[model samples]
Target: MVKQERAARTRQALIQAAAEVFAEEGFVTASLSTISKRAGVSNGALHFHFANKGMLADAVEAEAAKAVRLITEAARAWQGESLQAVVDATHELTRSLTHDTVVRGGFELAGDTTRRGEPSLRTQWRHWVEDSLRRADRNGALAEGVSWSDSARVIVAATVGFEVLGGDDTSWLSRQNVTRFWEVILPRLAGRQDLDRLVSSGSRPSAVVPSAERTSG
Candidate 1:
């Protein structure tokens, strides 16, 4: 039993260490040796816990998903908020999810993947984001006449763009600089009117666009 508990802790440590390193450095440059050192484990131990680098990457993604799901569940569990409050709550939830290190790292890794295909993990993230938007729309927080499913898709796409391009340029995510994003995009979405109330002052500007992209210049 003690051995099992120790193994679990070691696995979790590697997951966290890998996420941190991968997010800070592109996947190509992120080394298993660095992750092992960061986790305070020997490289052999890492191999024992994870079959290979790809397996560790998968574990990192799983940790990230769990972190994001927690934020989603928290927003859903809010019992007393009104429709506007709910939208506001969801907005906050998404912000936390986006900023989460584990969740954020998965995208950084996928972004650096050389394979010319979709990562299955990306579909899950998109579905989660879409679901959040749809829930807000169904609660009547969004304006009428907008297609919630499509709007959710667009919002998630826009979010990905923002995260990738806005890297260090938080200027776009600021209230003063990013209102243009809403000016151009909000009308197409369902919850603009409700969001106006929820995000009246403290709205997150936009997703942070990635800065210093290693590739895709």
Candidate 2:
């Protein structure tokens, strides 16, 4: 049992180290030896966990996907299928992009043209945003004549833009920036009545449970 636990820890450490290196150096230039060294583990330990750099990148992206799911799920739980949920999720997503290395690294990897894999993080986020907007449409939360597809496109583009810009300027990922974005768009996107209930600045953090605790529970 102890050996298994240690192996698990080592794997996670390697994943984290890889994320840091990938984020800073990009996938094509990042070395497995650098990742293993950053993880304070031997090259053999990294090899035992991940056969190649692609697999390590996949693990980083998978972990990031899980975090994204948790953020959207928490928002939905807090705000149901309303447009407010979409707003809240976007805020949380930006927050993660700003503060979470795994998320940032995964996104960086997704955008790395040198890497051949699909941009799983962006695709997952786009899907969730579209689905959330669709739900809001079904709930009659969207303004008249505003199609969910259009709204989804605008939101996804804006959020992804923020993520990309944030690589050099963290201000792009700030809560204030996200709030300002929602403030501008919510009025045009949400139904007249729903607009009053939506908080462009996002809901209280406590209202949405953290992904880590949610998963453990």
Candidate 3:
């Protein structure tokens, strides 16, 4: 048990170290030796955990995907078709990107053309937005004449734009910015009657759940 726990910690340390490197330096420029050194592990240990730079990047992306899935699944598990849930999830996603190196690196790495086998984080996010908006449209949460595809395109584009812009200026991911975005977009997308039901502040009950509780549960 002790050995297993230590191995898990080592792997996590390596993943986080790689995320920091990858987030700071693009995939092509990032070096495995640097990641191993940053992790305070020997190159052999890093090699034991991952075969190469691509594999280490894959691990980082996988951890990031786990984070994204947590945010999206929380939204999807909401009781009904809710644009509010989507709004909340977007805030969560942005928060993760800002605070979590794994998520930020995953997104950055996903855009790298050189990483042949890695999944596209943007594509996953776009599909989720499209599905969620379609569900909202069916439930009459959307304003009349608003198509889910159109709404999805706008939301996805804006979300990615924020993430990209935030890389240089963290102010882009500020609570004020996210709330302002929802304030501007929600009114146009949600039905008049449903407008009040949405939260522009990006608050979610799920936000109150402790990270340890979430990870354990």
For this target, which candidate reaches the highest lDDT against the unseen true structure? 2
TM-score of each: 0.69, 0.94, 0.93
Evaluate model 3: give its TM-score: 0.93
lDDT of 3: 0.84
Which runs of model 3 end up more than 4 angstroms from their true locations? 205-217
lDDT of 1 by residue, 1-217 (tens): 5998788878878887888888788666888899999999999999999887778878777765555455445445542232332333334433543455666677666677552264544566577656666666666756678776776667567656655654556443344333455555555553555545543322334433221121112
Best by TM-score, which number? 2
Q: Write the per-residue lDDT of candidate 2 for residues 1-217, one digit (tens) a residue.
A: 5998889888888888998999999999999999999999999999999999999999999888888888888888878998888888988898888767888999999998977568679999999999999999998989999999999999999999999999999999999999999999999999998888889999865434253552233
* Shift in Å, residue 139, candidate 2: 1.0
* Pick by lDDT: 1 or 2, better one: 2
Q: Residues 1-217, candidate 3, lDDT per residue (tens digit)?
A: 6998778878888988998998898989999899999999999999999989888888888877778887888766763568987887888888888878888999999878797565588888988899999999999899998898999999999999999999899889877898999999988999999998788976465463233433332
How high is the lDDT of residue 14 in model 2?
87
Where does model 1 exceed 4 Å of error? 79-99, 115-121, 132-140, 170-197, 200-217
